[model samples]
Each structure stands twice: as C-alpha cells, then as structure tokens.
Target: MTETILLTGAAGLIGRVVHHMLCERGDRVIAIDRIGGENITACDLTEVHRLYELAATVTAVVHCGAISGPMVARDNPFLIVSSNVVGTANVLELARVRKMRRVVCCSSVSAYGNTPAGLDLVPEDVPLRPTSVYGASKAAGEHLLDGYAFQHGIDGVSIRPAWVYGPGRTTECGIRTMILDAQAGRTTHFPFGCDFYRQYVHVDDVATALVLALDMEKLPRRSYTITGGSYITLAEVAQTVKRVLPQADITMGAGPDPIDDVQARFDISAAERDLGYRPYVTLEDGVCSYADWLAAQR
Candidate 1:
C-alpha cells in the first residue's frame, strides 16, 4: 500500500533519514522543510495557510520539526514554545481539517524531564512532571493530539524517542558533537560518571518505527515510547568510542551518578507487541558507524 506522506522538518536529523527511508521504500513523500531541496516542499509550518495548502494532498503526516536540543531550548525559550507547541497544534489541526488518514508525531523523552534523583526504569503511565520548558511543550503537544484523536477521529501516534543518532547529524546534536570531538582527538568529558544509563535509538530504526505506526491497521490512539533499548550510560558510550578510536583521549569526569527518574527509561513492550518495533543498532554499533561517518567528513 503506497500512500503519500507529508513529512515536516525534512532538513532535521531524523527527518532527513526518514525521508530517505520512505522514498527508498517506494512511498510518495512530500517533504516540507524551511529549506528547499530534492524531495522537499519549502514552507514554515507556523503559517496556517501554507501548512494547510501543503497538507491537503497528503494521505498522512509525520510532524518532526521543532526546537530540538536541550541547550538550544534554554537559549531560545520562546522559539521552543512556538515551534513545538504552536507549530504542533497547527499540524494536528491541519490533519484534522484535511481528513488525513493518520498523523504520526515526534514526541521526546525530554517530555519526562530530568530523571528523578535515584530510581530507574521510568514508565509511560507516570505523571508527566517536566522540568524544562521543552519537556512541557512536548507534553502539551501530546495532549493536543490526544484531544484530536478523541474528538476528531484522527488516528495519532506519539513516539517518545531517546538519544537518537545517525548520519547527516548537524552540529546541534550532543551525540554528534561528542563523536566529532573524539574524532578530532579532543578530550570528551564524561559528565556525571560512567554508569549513567541512557537509551539511544538509531535514526534508521526510528524511521522504521514511524512507518510502522503509520501503517498499523488497529493501534491504540495513544502515545508509545519508541526507545532503542535499555539505557547506556555516559561511561558505556565513552568506552564504545575508545574501542574504535583508541586515542580518542576522552576523559571520564566525576559527578553525581546520573539520576533515572520520571520517564527516563520506557518499557517498550507496548511498541513490541503493537508495532513490532525492535531496535536493530546497539550503542556500540551506532558509535562505530557514526565515527566512520565523522572521519569521512574531516
């Protein structure tokens, strides 16, 4: 079943990878990004008329654009709100008005906020007590989608992804930055000790999950955590880098052990049963592949 997909944020990390994957699989993708290029339909999603015009022809939509980094959010709080909250609402409403078949949105693990001081394995049902404005915006977006699903009958799936990494990552992403620093023989400091568990999902796997969520015939009209697997701490991530780049010169810094709280770690059992989403790339494999790609860029 080949359906036309309207993909927002085609220039972003996950967007770029997902656009390619969708095209390769013979899906007609009308990609919209701030910048225009091959397979891209240039439009700022904040503009209501422009968004509606572009969304009119597509069968489904994958909303991935937003103010995405932790540091970026702190610097531009207003942009974060406008892009994640306002922009998301626009996309959802457009989908509703256009009568699109399904809408898949990019929620975040950030919605969980800073992990609680000590506990691990944060579940989806936990109360959403977000610490950052970014997290709040995402939680709000999920609520908007939930409302739409209940009233408008627009099938919506919210995927809360963890540390996602892959090729074509710009300088904005922390994981990509770490990979770049290691490649340059720069000392990459491991903040908050080594054993801090953090889950990582490959861009390709996330793309796959998005496609599955879009196609699943009978799925719950709720959000699901699309993590790669168990959380791998900073220490484990650094060690993986060392394996490939022996002289990476990364240093492990001392700090309080990373806290696992709120929605830090998700039980992906729901995704496994519903969407059949099992992450293929491990952290080590992803780092090695990312390191190779980084080396090519230099």
Candidate 2:
C-alpha cells in the first residue's frame, strides 16, 4: 500500500535508512530533519503548530525525531522531557486532529530500565521502570501514544528498539567506537557493558520495524520491542570485532554500563507474529558492516 507519510528525523541513522525504504517501496515521504539535510526540511517538532500543517497532506507518520538517546544531553533533563515528551504530544495531537491512519513512534528500550537481572525475556506488558530522565521521557511518550490511540481514537504504536547501531550514527555507541578504534589502530579501553547482557539491533532491522508498523494490515498492540536477538556484551562485541579485524586490541572493564543497568532479555515474538518481523543483520555481520563503513569514511 502506498502512503503519503511525514517522516521526522530524516537525517539520523534509522531515518536515513527508513526514508530510502519508504521511497523505494513507492511511498510519498514528506521528510523533515531538525538539523536539516539534503532534500530534508529543517524543523523542530516541539514547535507544535509547524507539524500540524502536514497533517492535512499526509496519511500517516513515521515519528523518529526526539532527544534520540539517554547518553545525549545528559545534563539537560528538561531538553529530554521537552523534545521526547512534548514532541511526542505534538505528533499525537496532529494525528488526532487529522484523524491520520497510523503513527509509528520510534520509542526505545531505555523505557524498560531497571529490569531485574537475568529476568526471563521481558515482554511489552512489563511495567516500565525508567531510571533516567531520558528513559522516563520515552516511557511517557509511549503512554501518550497509547492514550491517543485509545481515548483520542487514533492508531498509534511505539517501537522500543534495542541500542540501534549502524552508519550515520551521530551518538556515542560502544560498538562503533570499538570498530573505529580498530580502524584507527588505537587501543580500546572501554569503561563498561563488558559482561552485561544487552541487545543491539542494526539500523536496517529497526527501519524494517518502522515500515512494518506503518504498512501492517492491522496492529494488535500499542508497543513492540526489537533486538539483534541476543544478549551481547561489550566484551562479546570486542570479540566479534577481532573476528573481523584480527589485530584489533580491545580491553573492557567488568561492570554494568554506566549509561544503563537494564539487563533484561527481550522477547520479540510479538513483533515477529504481528509485524512479520525478523532481524536480517547478525551480530557478526553488523560488526563487519560497521567496521567496513568506518574504514571507507576515513
């Protein structure tokens, strides 16, 4: 099915990938980026009225614009709340007023913070326990989206993708940094996430989830969690890098990553059954892809 969609965060990693996917699949994309990029409109989503204008022309939205990650703007909780929370409200409102078809909100696994260690695959229904302000913002965004879908009678869904990593990544990713270190012939002294079981899905896999949510015949839930399908540690990630770059010398401390302590494994069966979602990028392949991409950039 073809859709005239408004895609926010058009310049970021997942946005860059999803924009191409939308256009390739014969959908009309009114792409906008807060930072401004080629063929992308520069606009801040927090400016509520600005996006409402697109509501008339677009059938649905792929809302990816936000504070992005908990690591970013760590010192500014207000920015996290405003951009992640208020920005979501604006998008939900636009969808509500226009009675748009659907809204695929780009949420985060950060929302499921403070999970019990080694807990069985965490499901979407788990009560959110956000530890940081950024995490709380994402959880709040999900609630806003869900409420809009129910009370306001608009179709909305949130994707809590695990630590997304791929090309055009503008944030600090441990995997990316380790690969970059290998490319630059530098020793890697990573601080954390060496033993912690965490998931890292590639940007391509995440873009697929966004598209599935946008084009699905029917959605049965308000949220979905996606991952690389394994609890991989930074130490394990380092080993994967060395598998590709044999000479890569990497060392990591033995502690939970300071950025987060959410160590619960995730069950993606809901996404698999509903969205027909299955990850295409394996951990080793993702490491190879990122390493090769980094090499070409230099």
Candidate 3:
C-alpha cells in the first residue's frame, strides 16, 4: 500500500536525503519546508492551521524541521523557541487531532549536554542535561513527544543523531571543510588538534533509521541514539581525507582537544534492536565518497 508521509524540513540536509529515500521506496511524500523548493511546499511549522491541514491526508510525519545547531540557537534564541518548541508542539498536536499513524522526530546528541568526562557509551536512559539553547529545544521536543505518546495515544519516536555527514553536507564542520579544501587543491589549516574525538553517522544511515522508525509496527522505546559505531578524532578524519586525495595539503593547530571531555560515544543497541538500525558506512568510505562528490561538483 502506498502511504503518504508528511516530511517537514524537506530542503534540509537530512530532510532531503530522507525525502529521496522515501520516494524511491514508492512512498507518497508531502515535502514541506520554510523555504520553498521545486517539489516542497513552503510553510512555517508554527502555523497550526496549515500543519493541521497538511496532516489531514498524510498517514505519518517525519518531523525534521527546526532551528538546528548550537550556534544558530545561541544567536537567535527567540527563533529557536518559536520554531523548535512551538513548532514541535504543533506537530504533535496535529498527530493527536488527525489520528496520524506515526511520527519520527529528528533530535540531536547535543541534548545530552556536557556529559561527565570519560563517560563512554552513553545510553538512552541517561538524563538529558542540555548545554545550549539548541540542545534544550531538542530535549523539550523529545519530552513533548513522550507526553503525547503516553497521554494522547500518539505513536511516535525521536531519533538522536550525532554529527551526521555525507555528500550534500554544506555545514562548517572540520571533516566537511577538510574535504572541500582537499577537493579544491587548497591547503587546509584546521584549528583543532588530532585528539579531538567526535561521533559521526552517515546522512544515509540516519535516513535509514528514520525510515525504519516509520515502518516499525510497534515502537518499544520512545527514543533511540543513532551514531557511527565509534568515535573518531579530527586528526583521523583529516587523515582519511588525505588518503582519499593523496598530495592534498592539510594541517591542524597544536592544542589539546577542547571538546574531548564533553563528548561521549553513544551506545546504539536500542536502535539496533528496535529499529534494526546498523550504520554501514565506515568513516574512511564515507569521506572518500564525499571527496569524490566534491571533486565532481567542481
């Protein structure tokens, strides 16, 4: 049966990938974003009437729209509150009123805030202690979904992803910047040293997890962590870039890893068990693919 899915943030990094995957699988996708695109309907999520209208026909929703990233939230706190918080409420409310089958919200690992130093393998049961406005907003969104699921009988799950990277990534991350610089044959000097570790999941893997959550007949857990199996340092990422593009010039500043103490590798066993999520793209393979894509674009 063809199911109609209302996908918010249809033009976003993750949204675009999910949209393509859903369409390829023969699902009817109703793509919407604040910014209009060729096939995406333009609408602000906070507009409750519009959301309710859109939800009337869709069987499920994959809510990926938000004011993402810490810096964006830090700079525009008001926008974050209105969009991420209020917008999330609107989405859940639509689910409740429309009797939608399911909703899969895209969350972030930043919701864990500053984890205790050396606290490896952070689990889903860990208490959320958000360190930034963006993290706080995502935490709030998760809580709202949980409440809706329990009280209003809405079926939903929130996926907390870490440092998602892939071909279409335009964000200013160390790995992405290095790949672009290498592709352009420019010497890249990153400020962070080699020991800085961060967990990354391929954008496609994250998309797969979202689809899995949507397809599950029943969800055992309301939330799950999805990340690359292990942590890789910035130095390692740069090395992968150089290996992919031999003779590429890249250097890093000398300093201790500033974020090492705060970051924790996620234990994705719950996602594996519940959603059948397994990250297939290794860091080396993902970087090499990204570098190749970059080269083709130039």
Candidate 4:
C-alpha cells in the first residue's frame, strides 16, 4: 500500500538516505527542510502552523530534523534548545491533532551521558544524564514524545543511533575524515588519543532501523539503541584504515581520552527483539565501501 510520509530534515545525511529508500520502495515522501533543495519544501520546523498543514496529508512522520552536532550545541545553546526541543514539541502536537499512526524519531545515544568506569555498554533503561547540550536536547525530545504518547495516546518510537557515518555526511567525524583522507593519499591526524572509542553505525543501517520502526505493526519498546556490530577504539579504526589502504597515513595524539567518559558500547538486544534490527556492516567492510565511494567522487 502506498503511504504519504512526512520526512523532516530531508536533506540531512540520514534523512536523505531514508528519503531515497522510501521513494525506491514506492512510498510518497513529503520532504521538508530549512534549506531549499530540488524537491524539498523549505520550512522551519519551529513554525507550528506550517507543520500542521503538512501533517494533515501524510499518514506518518519520520522526524530526522534538528540542530545536531556537539560543537553547535555548545556554541549556540538557544538554537539547539528551540530547534530540538521546541521543534519536536511542534512535531508531536501535529501528530496529536492529526491522529497519525506512528512517528519514528531519530534520537541519539549521547542521551546516556558520562557513564562511570566499568559500566561500558548502555541500554534503553539507563538514566538519561546528558553531558552536552545536544544530548540534553535529544533527551528532551524523547521525553516530549513520551509525554504526548501518554496524554494523547500517540504511537511514537524513538531510535537512538550512535556515531553514524557514510556518504553524504555533512558533519566532521574522525572515521569519515580518515577514510576520505586515506582515499586521497593524504596524511590525517586526530587530536583525540587512541583510548577514545565509539560505536559507529553506517547511515544505511540507521535508515533501515527507522523504516523498520515505522513499518512495525506494534512497538513494544519506546526507544531502541541502534548501533554498529560493536564498539571500536580509535587505534582499531586506524588499523582498519591501514589494512584497507596500505599507503594511507593516519595518526592520533598521545594522551588520555580528552572527551567525556561516556559508554561507547550499547546493548541493542531491545532493538533486535522488537524491530529485528541487526547491523550488517562490519568496520572493515564499511570502511572499504566508504573509501570506494570517496574514490568515485574524485
């Protein structure tokens, strides 16, 4: 059956992939973004009236829109709050008014902030202690959705993706930068030390998780941690790059991890059981595929 889907942030990395997947699967996508694109309707999500108008025709909403990135949130806290928190409220209100079937919110694992040592893998039940403003905004968004769901009986699910990377990535991530630099035969140096670790999920897998959540008949869990196969350290990432491209040069600074002490690993059993979410891309294969894509762009 054909469904009209409202896709916010349609031009963003994950949103773009999800839009493509939806279109390919014969679904109608009402793509909206703050920035104008070929087929994307330019509109700010904070405008509640405009969202209500857009939501009336769509059966579901895949909200991938927000002021993302840690640095942006740190520098401009107000924009982060308004765009993430206020904008999310607008989306949920639209859903409530329209009585939409389900809404799949693209959340982040950063919500589980500053985990203590020896507690490596985080789960959905972990308390949301956001260390950064961006994480807090995401946590707030999740809370807002839950509130709406409880009060208005909205069927909403939030998918928390960790360190997403792939083609069309707008922001700067260590792995993406290293892979592109290696493809260009340029030396790459990272400020963070080798101790730094993250659970990196490919953009395609994240998009798939969102679609799965959207298509499911019933959602038992409100939020699921969707990540890569496992957590990997920066040193392991460099090794993978070197293994793929022997001539590539990559180095990391020597010191303790300067970043916040958050759990880099996540137990995604909830996602697997509820949504059949399984990350098929391994680090080696994903890097190689990304490198190939970078080479083609040159």
Candidate with top TM-score is 2
Task: Report clash pairs, candidate 4.
Answer: none
Question: Judged by lDDT relative to the true structure, which candidate is superior, 1 or 3?
Answer: 3
Residue 54 local lDDT, model 1: 69
Expressed as tens digits, the lDDT of each residue in 19-50 for candidate 4 is 99999999999999999597899889987778
Give model 1's TM-score versus the native structure.
0.92
User: For candidate 1, lDDT tens digit of each residue in 1-298?
Assistant: 7888999889888888889888988999889987767768788778889887766678899888887655565877888899899999999988988899989998888787765655556667666767788888989999999899989998898988876777766645546767788777687775655655667788878888887888899886477788878566667777777786787766666553443333446788888899989998877788788777878878
Which TM-score value belongs to model 3? 0.94
Clashes of 4: 0
Query: Which runs of model 2 end up more than 4 angstroms from their true locations?
Result: none
Worst 10 residues of 1 by lDDT: 255-264
Q: What would the per-residue lDDT of candidate 3 be over residues 34-75, giving only the tens digit for each residue?
A: 996978999899777887777678889999999866755466
Q: How does model 2 fare in lDDT?
A: 0.87
Candidates' lDDT values, in order? 0.79, 0.87, 0.85, 0.85
lDDT for 116 (candidate 2): 64
Q: Answer with 2 or 4, whichever has the higher TM-score.
A: 2
**lDDT per residue (tens digit) for residues 159-256 in model 2:** 99999997778588888888888788899997766787678999999999999999897899989999988787778888888998888899887888
In model 4, which regions exceed 4 Å deviation?
A: 254-261, 296-298
Candidate 2's TM-score = 0.97
